[model samples]
Target chain A: MGPDSSQDAQTISQVGEFGLINRVTSGRAQSPGTLLGPGDDAAVLAAPDGRVVATTDVLVEQVHFRFDWSTPHQVGRKAVAVNLSDIAAMGAVPTGLLVGLGCSPDLPTTVVDELAAGMWEEAQRVGISVVGGDMVSATSLTISVTALGDLQGREPVTRSGARPGDVVAVAGRLGWSAAGLAVLGRGFRSPVAVVGAHRVPEPPYEAGPQAAVAGATSMVDTSDGLLADLGHIAAASGVAVDVRTELVEVPQRLTEVASALGADARHWVLTGGEDQALVATFPQGRPLPEGWRPIGAVVEGEGVTVDGDAYAGPSGWEHWR
Target chain B: MGPDSSQDAQTISQVGEFGLINRVTSGRAQSPGTLLGPGDDAAVLAAPDGRVVATTDVLVEQVHFRFDWSTPHQVGRKAVAVNLSDIAAMGAVPTGLLVGLGCSPDLPTTVVDELAAGMWEEAQRVGISVVGGDMVSATSLTISVTALGDLQGREPVTRSGARPGDVVAVAGRLGWSAAGLAVLGRGFRSPVAVVGAHRVPEPPYEAGPQAAVAGATSMVDTSDGLLADLGHIAAASGVAVDVRTELVEVPQRLTEVASALGADARHWVLTGGEDQALVATFPQGRPLPEGWRPIGAVVEGEGVTVDGDAYAGPSGWEHWR
Candidate 1:
């Protein structure tokens, strides 16, 4: 019989807590930074920088993801990706992850196996490991990930460091996840590009430290769209941010998809979120880092604007708004 | 109006994500270890030991706590306490915490405020702070806390180090939370000592590192009762543990309460969990730590026995079994 078939035959309740923990942790290779891995009360990780960057993100089933739209593996990858992106946004390289999972007792064990596999996949991409985690029973599935990172002797780039003269640039894809969400909402999922992007974001993890090495003043991941995230930098730094739309690239693929859906591609490029792209501000006249392209500039004032004017659309996604 | 009256009038949805974040974080004093507090993508914390100890625990409403029995503030304190105790179990001092909260949108903002306050209260007790967190919407309340700690250049006291000639010792109250849970289960709340323990645990956080300094062979916290948690050490260290009933102290108050309820105080002390007490094994000839009392001995065997016999009760609590 296939692994899925056997796994489907068992539920989380049947496997039990210790049994489930063993299944997820056994035989997994740990990174060298993991001084002590799972099975203990806690995990120990090497922090050579003498400081650790920590961030957490919670993803709830139906609220943050839908099983009908994405598989359990995809959900797990996205959950870890979002938190790892937060670490990267701080100009740090991730070292380890701790997951807190709560799910229904009736859920199939296969879902958990797949979810763990996906989380490992994402952590492996950055050479980190899920050093420790907790699993418990709840009414619905909730994935909470805490990613610990090392600054590597570099100053952490925070949102408040963006100066008035700093030029803003971004690396990685934009508008793709948002476009995919629109396609899924319209009940047409044939465009695998956008759909897959929605399921699993391709965050430019390395660009964060790269930007920091190049003396970038501020950095943030594009989790709340370009304009909204930049607004955070502006507010924190006591400066205004203006995006030059002409300089922003709206990929032809997104344009085609938007045209077919009768939506604005530029809006997606400007306000789309969850792409996990890194946006940072650097000193003016300095050559931009590789893979980063200039898209805006910081000025004296407050809030974010597009082409010297406020973008005439919802800036980004907000919970309970 | 009183703070509760005003806060009760506002639901989480009305307060919104950003507003709720501001309410919890504003005016809070961050610890020196917290190089960067909440408000950014991630927080930076000092790991002076060059190795960071991390652990996570998830508490779900009804599954882990009941609103009818405990206040939100107490639940919050318990949640943070559990994670901190895990850090202590590693023979480390906690540095910071990251909370991931998932609750209903219609939940009162007062609950959130109280929860945050309680978390801060517990964190301050250890000279730490809630450095970072994530808030999301879910059907039921779920609190996930991840605690980071420093070993202070000491080797982590893991569970796999106990030897056959080691003496088992415990510091801090044992079975108090379990007694409180039993009282609560019986619908009596007057006995504040035990009932209050059920609400918030007082872990012997300092005893962990102290035990390590005194050359503890192995250490663990009594979150799963003395015998069950000792079972972990026994299995991990390839040894057997025998608890002498005469040596194990059953508090007089617990005995009185148990008699009134027709329960066994010794059983509670042996099998009741969630007291957050520190238990460790020391060399047979070495003196135990200041607060620790010797209660058992390790030998060549497997599993835990009480007074040279198997305890005739449920060993400990397990999530699904």
Candidate 2:
């Protein structure tokens, strides 16, 4: 059987802890750099370039995702996606993952199996594997994923290197996830694409290392909305970023959905989070890399502005808020 | 101010998520392998030997730690300690950690700060840093820790490498945590040391690499009971392990506490877990390393036998059961 065929209807407690783990991990393929996989004291991954990029993210039920809105598979995929976005932001090639899952013991074992299946499916897309993990019983469902990546001996594209007069660009779509969230909230049957985006964001993973190769000075993943995340870059680089919203291309689907919901599509495009689009700053005359399109420019100042004006709407999603 | 002075009385929502993260991470020192610390999308670490060892563990309130029983500081320390023990079991030198915390929004923000302080304090003991993390709101308090380690060019001593003629030995205390658990269960105010073990286990960190240097054939940490964890080794190695109970020197303190609680000290020594002592198999003629004492030997068969008989007591902690 191919990877991810271990589907069982048994409850976690019925299968027992070890038995459930074995069922979830059965028939998985180990990717390159994973010298050792799960079932060991710890897994080993090769870091040939002598450095590894590491990041972690947590997703909580009701807080991050609701079972009614998304399947367990989608939740699992989203968990890996968010963590992978952080690794991508570092301009690194994703290598491996360690997943920590906390769930109610009474939950059907098939839920965990599906979660593991989705995780493996996503990791496989990036040519990586879930090398190690831990599982525990908890009152609420929670997923914690830590992603490891390799830089291949190149300098990491950090947020602090943006220079005045640099071109600010983006890869992939923005506002999709936020739009998806709205669609779900209003109980509207959004377009399949929009609903899927809300369930599992599609990050521009390859754009990160590609930007680094094309001499991008700074880079970040738009996790907490385009404006808010760019504000981070502007703050760190001691420069101002101006995004000409007109220059940002938004799909017709978003505008259509916004009109139907009596919301401004621009609001989602500017303030939406979890789209995971890669944003970078490059020297003004440098050739933009493939998959990247200029959205605005870096200027001499502080904070982020759209059309040279400070954004007045809600900035982004804050966990406490 | 020192590295861990972020204590405050404000609630998490009052401090705000980012503000609390800044407060908790303030003044911490970067360990040797840390190339980049927090505040970025991710962190970078040096893996000098071209490989990195990784492990993760999750601790949930009520399931793993009760607020009435463990101080938040102890809970935080225990989270890191358990993850570290896995790295140690792989005979690797820990270099960094990525922590994920989920807690009720109503929690006093100082609790998170104290938890972070405790994590930093424990990580400092082994000269590592909390490189990155994610925080979110949940119904229950949860801590997920992923530890990264360097093997330092030595072959990892996996549980499957033991031979029939190899000697079985361990470093660090056994049964103390189990005995301590009984004391706590009885509602008896035990000695500070005993109570401390149950709250925050002290693993013999140095002995992991020491065993590797001494050519340990197989290794594991006794996170599960001695028989259960060693059963893992036995099953993996396709050999039987024979433990001589007489050779196991249980401290008189454990016996005294066990009697006071109307429990069998030997039962705790044989079936209790979470002590995190390093157990390994070495060549029969090889001398036991300092801090390690021989307690058993690998025999020709599968499964573990205590004094040539199967253990009948509870095996160990099972997440489901």
Candidate 3:
């Protein structure tokens, strides 16, 4: 078995918290940049690029996922995924992750191990290592992940760079996670592929850098709805956004899921979050990349609209109840 | 008045969650390297060192703090302090923070604002900004914080660099937080200073980089008991540690509290956690800088000891009951 394959739910639960942590850190290759891996106050990484891009996210059980709903691996993957998305949004490649976990002792050691395995799997996907973390006992499980990214000699993309006439585009699918969420919330399961989308978000991890290289401005990861995310760009750049739905193409799988679940694919596209798709504004006449699509354009109004009409679905995911 | 001064604890409750967050993000002088401050999918920051140092910590009411014992501001400070300590442990300077909050609506808005105010106040101490965060509703109050640091052309200090003859030293106070915790748990308030220590730990923040500059091989923050943390170093660095009790400097304040409470101050010193002090190893003949005290030396052994003997004390803080 490979580094990731030496994991299982049974072994995960039986391993003590520290034991589980040791397993996660064992046999992993550290970046020549890493001075420390785990089991310390903090892990150190080399920053030859002269600066670092940083972000964090916290996942709470029941709020983000339920033990009954998500396996330990799934939870771990989600924890790392959301934080990695933050780094990707800044057009930086992630280097290391520090995780702080609060869990109930009654939670089997295997469950926590599975979570670590999932995190490791995701960390491998991004070519980064899980460096350091903290573990504490709590009433429920909470995973707080912080990701550090290496910019590698590039300026970070902020939300304030979209010019009024810049063309707006996206490099990944929309509403897929939301469609999966709707299906799960309705006591239904999507097809294996769609269910997998809900279990683990397969973001276009390389697309953010490609867009950056293509001279994109004001890029963001769509963890919220597309309109809500674009609204951020609109507010930051002081430009109105007019998305041409006629040019928007829905993933056929998502449409089938929406159809089976009796939901509008557009609603999911408009409001679903956690897809972590990269959206950016490019100067007019910019050549589009192969995977990117021109779904919208910058305009002279205040809010974002679809095909020139205001979208009235839910604005985005609100953390507070 | 300053951005934080105008808002009193009373009107703060009325300010509501979003309102309080808006206050936290209101006009301020952002640090030089912050590309984006807040209010986006994720905040963008310039990693001047080319690599971001990151760590996460979660604070839960009742488990980490009691509302009765700790004011909201203190809670906020501790939340930030612990994570900042992690960054410091990495021998890096902090640059930004992401905060995710979950609390009951019945919780006062003033409390939330005070939390932010405290977070901001502490953030400035490390030259980092409150770059981004999340807010949500939940059964209890939870503050999950991720801190990002910049490594300023130096390698991060880790737990595995000690050799057989390195001098082990520490660069801050030890055991005050645990002593304060004992006071609170026993329904006795310590004197002003000791009681205050429980609310907000004063870690030797600068000592991190100073130690790094002084050519320390390995370093860790004593948030866990000294032995527990050093045991980690010993295991990773493949060395044994012998801490000298005669050389141990017990804080006089702790002695008084231990006497009044009929507890052992030595226990607090030996096993108490949350000191956030910098403990590091230096090669023989390499002198420790000011603010650091030589405490012990690394040897060829398996575990940690005090006064050349195995210590049978409280061991350390245990999260799960």
Index of the highest-DockQ prediction: 1
Give the alpha carbon lDDT tens digit for every residue of B1-321 in model 3: 766665443343345545766877887567887876776555667667766677777888888888899888988888999889888887888888888777765666777878988888888887777888777565667788888787788887878898989999998888788888888888877576777788898888899988888888888888778888888888889899999887789989899889998989988887888878888999989878899998898998878989778888766654553
DockQ category of candidate 2: high
Fraction of the real A/B interface contacts present in each candidate? 0.86, 0.87, 0.48
RMSD, every candidate, angstroms: 1.4, 3.0, 4.0
Tens digits of lDDT, candidate 2, B75-116:
888899988888888899999999999988879987897789
Model 2 alpha-carbon drift over 4 Å, by segment: A1-9, B1-8
Write candidate 3's Cα lDDT for A156-240 as tens digits: 7778788878888887778878887777788766576666677778778787777777888888888877888888889888888
Compute the lDDT of residue A36 as modeled in candidate 3.
58
Docking class of 3: acceptable
Q: How well is candidate 2 docked (DockQ)?
A: 0.85
Which one wins on lDDT?
1
- TM-score list, all predictions: 0.98, 0.97, 0.90
Candidate 3's chain A scores what TM-score?
0.92
Q: Judging by lDDT, tell me the better candidate of 2 and 3.
A: 2
The whole-model C-alpha lDDT of candidate 2 against the native structure comes to: 0.90
**How should the candidates be ordered by lDDT, best one leading?**
1, 2, 3
